[model samples]
Target: MRTSSTIRTRVTVKRTTRAAAALAAGALALSLTACGDDDKGDDSGDKGGGTKQPGVSVTLPKLDGESLSVAAVWTGTEQKNFKQVLTEFEKRTGAKVTFVPAQDPIINFLGSKIAGGAPPDVAMLPQPGAIKQAVDKGWAKPLGAEATKELGENYSQGWQGIGKVGGKQYGVYYKAANKSLIWYNARVFENAGAAEPKTWDELLNTAQMVYDSGVTPFSVGGADGWTLTDWFENVYLSQAGPEKYDQLAQHKIKWTDPSVKEALTTLAEIWGKKDFVAGGASGALQTEFPASVTQAFTGGDQPKAGMVYEGDFAQVNIGETKAKVGTDAKVFPFPAVGDTAPVVSGGDAAVILKDSKAAQALATWLASPDAAAIQAKLGGFLSPNKSIDSSVYPNEVQKKIADALIAAGDDFRFDMSDQAPQAFGGTPGKGEWKTLQDFLKNPKDVAGAQAKLEADAAAAYGG
Candidate 1:
């Protein structure tokens, strides 16, 4: 689901249906009166100020008396401010987009619409896993080769790899939110008699020292099923790397894997500690993640304890708090448990319902370097385009993320549950996320839960 517009605390629509309808009708009349405008050769020229150069010439299909309607699910508080981007695209391409703002659970909107045969031309899928579901159900089409070629590599690969379930691209993923960093209070480290740890051992020692000093080392709100699962996925990948994580997602690696057991046990140990997390284990399980994160940052007038591990989205969640970036809070990539290369958690790119020329045009644009830069600049989001310059980042953390992405070698990966099937359906091991959530809340039932999941997986996968 796309993060709710509620979190944005605002809304704005620049292009109304009336205006879009007029533009669509206008573009069509122009194409008909100027028949040569729709010719394949005449259309290949760049529509914008000019082609970025050396890239495939992008000529949007002559609107031919038509327009593209995009059903987008945006996250954070900045989505409402995106009318400018949409307006910019319209001006540059001479094609108008009718964008409908999906409030929340954008996946449900996409699924319901595509199933009804009234699919939106383009969709902003906040969660990659949902993209997988859309593709599996034949709700989308593989983006054309021209679109894939123009979008560059990362944006293309991110969506293509996962979007292609059996060898067809379903969507082009454009933006992503970075995960895998722990946000901590610098002052707390100074007052708690601690320093930033360089390695996993040092981190754990520091955590213990903070606890010994009568402070909470970590404040994880696991009540939201997604929050607890983030910890498990991060820990598992840190311990097992991307290969194993992918295996887990594909159901080739069982939750019974020793490494899987280790990941869960590591979380269990943390839960076993009373003050390690705010609100305790039960509180962690019941408390909402964003709210608990806020409590950790500003529980008291002087600021609560020390740290909270969360994603880049933390800014929207904690922007109003006294814990401002570069001061009360700073981030560090989750340390490698051993010799493993640090893996950053992030969203995957994907495309859906790809048959339309409008969808292809948009996908091509999204994959372009210009689109990548725009996302980094205007959207305050990460673009998978490795070719993009790191100087585009507005902050130190974002710069670090760009650098980390470049240095990741082959270890870059997304979360397992995100790569898993939706909660209600799909193949067996591919669908145990909810079960894991239940087990986390009741550790004693781990074995029973694992057995049930394994049985179900066997049945679904026909193993």
Candidate 2:
């Protein structure tokens, strides 16, 4: 890919029934606890008025005397920050709110619970695949027209339409991490007399030049089988644009398209040169994700390494372990390849459940400008509300990324695996990813790989 962004693949979203069965088999259950009167307790005092607003609302027959609960994956210091927000929300609404902070695996647990007929009113999911699973099983409720109206013009059309599966709105997304950009060590490129490339061919030349200098151009771990997939997605995007690929994911287009072959051919050329990727192909397959990132940031970590393409979330991890942005690091858009336009991939949506007066209140609150500000401060995400200013970004790099995304216009889209069947990652092992990576290793074999992928996708889609 031309720019420094890494495309990611969401894992196979197991079949809806399987998700339900897994939920049932796991016995994932939650019990509610009462929150005694705090300043944030119900303000209405009217028997029913007590049922609405900010904090814990325990009015449903199943949760009577219980408190309003919100479950999400933010933990430790982040969780503490979220709780502080909840406390402030409670103080403002007099609603008793309970925050159930959990771990990543809990998504499955939540999915299982939802399958068995219970789900958290809200969750802070970092990805979209699980939400797709929830919506597919009819376990999620659309956030509705009012919520959409409230979203105003604050976000991009891509973010607004991300949750609308099969023309029916399913969930609201509030968290997002942009992945169509690359962060690199400014000093390394400067010292190497290299400039950031804006087009695919230039990028390849840069990679080869860096390799010739004896430094690896990229650091990645393909062992998990997911790492190599990132490069593939970006390649597909640069070659095929969004709408056509969306059709491909929906089984409306053939994987054997010339565009697909071109994308795969590009990846094969890179993979064929053992010196391009930090570790050769085999070494890449054995490396670990976090460690590979660490290697990218080591001082003068060039010729051996100069750049790494990843999502904005990597900034947090990098901050925690290495240098901060603008100083030790900087990011640029993934370059446009061949005749393709610049493209970006990331951003999430928000879905509302419950639909009670309180739920409606919460949805309204989330879709408000004030809510977007709070999310910026607390969640570190770009708000979907159009009224919010770009000043909310934490750094210049973020602002540049956002500007690039906005400029991308219709070219902005989500990764196809995020738009495909859940078995996308598992059954096919690498699914479309393997096809692209394999083709990169042998471009002349493109037709065979293309045919194989089409067959696999057809079977998966039951075409």
Candidate 3:
């Protein structure tokens, strides 16, 4: 969307379980350890007391001598940072905390554990949809009053609400992502003599300019339909404001709505162009997400694409490549076509599975500003906790990104596709991914794509 400064203040949220699940599955899984030195950030004393989540309780309860088990999708540095939070919690409460990898299909993993009569006390779920699913299955327990209060104080009411599924509060969102961002190679932009695009028109012009410079304009990873949906959602949010975003997300507005078609049509203006994309449209459909990012940064002997559109978390992938971030690699807000930068976001929520004073105490601590600030000092992390100090972040770019989010406040919308059903959102050979892939293959048939989306969404959401 527009510059990061143009963050909107009005917020609306309506997302399908399928869409949230699908989006979170791809967007939220990475740990920065594989990327760079996380310890690079300033890890000074917790001077203002222990690192906390924003807002709520003045004092956390002492649950000393108790042992607790926690699980999350985080694998590397993220787990390390979280352990830091847990370590603080343990230090204060005298409880033992263990971090476990909550395997993908995290639900299935938890199910087996639960069936065996030993599910982790707390689980960090990738999607609000997953939290809702666990809540529905009766696996998730409500947060304690302190956790609930801190959740309300630290996060926006919308975020507070999302943590609640089926009228009961059960989860606390710990991390967030600005999905409406396009990460590109700085050299490519400089070489092409093109500034980062500030609008959709500029984006097209930059794409053409880069293409004319002998390299592909974009590294489209259509091999993964999830990436395709992120492309659509950003455009849709910018074209349509938060209200329509919520409506379409909830299926309150059908995918066949004229607005949906318009978004697709607008997307066509770029995707419709021949060789406007890397590997042409056909080759793009086969390129997976990693290849897409690497394609943008790839230099030396192989061909390189100029740009890639992904979330803030893409830094992990960027770290994997030979390119240098914030210099060789830079990011701009996804160019806006509508009134403001279409800010869509997603994050993992921590929910308690089995209730105990220790579990609730840990959950409460996780929701505190102290807990968040501890991890914030470590690079590559963003928290929605409003009470956290901006200075906690390691760099200006991150601060700006975090500020864009904080400035947006309640106005931010969760990724719409993430609100749909699993079969529709996350399921590969079916739903939006396949349909969007088809549409990408032939973008001019906007109506055809709209019809397919509606049909699939109806079946999945209706059921």
- Winner by TM-score: 3
Ranking by TM-score: 3, 1, 2
Could you list the CA RMSD of all candidates, in the order they appear? 12.6, 11.2, 7.1
Worst 10 residues of 2 by lDDT: 28-37
Q: Mind giving the per-residue lDDT tens digits that candidate 2 earns over 302-368? A: 4246777655545544554455566566665556564443333444344444455445445545555
Cα misplacement distance, residue 58 of candidate 2 (Å): 22
Every candidate's lDDT: 0.55, 0.53, 0.70
Question: Candidate 3 residues 1-463, lDDT tens each?
Answer: 1001111101113232333423332222221112233453223333223334244334566665788899875655456666888877776677788998765446778989999998999988765666777888999999888888888888888778778887889988877766666877777777788887778999999988888877777778787776778788878877876678889888998998989988999888777888777887898998866677777887832246888887665665665678777677777767767765555566777899979988988888778777788777765567778888867676556666666566555544566665676567655668998999999899888888988899999998983
**Candidate 2: Cα lDDT at 300:** 49
Model 3: per-residue Cα lDDT at residue 75: 58
Q: Is candidate 2 or candidate 3 better by TM-score?
A: 3
Q: Which whole-number lDDT from 0 to 100 does residue 412 have in model 2? A: 41
Q: Each model's TM-score?
A: 0.77, 0.72, 0.81
Rate residue 332 of model 3 by lDDT.
74
RMSD of candidate 2 to the truth, in angstroms, is 11.2
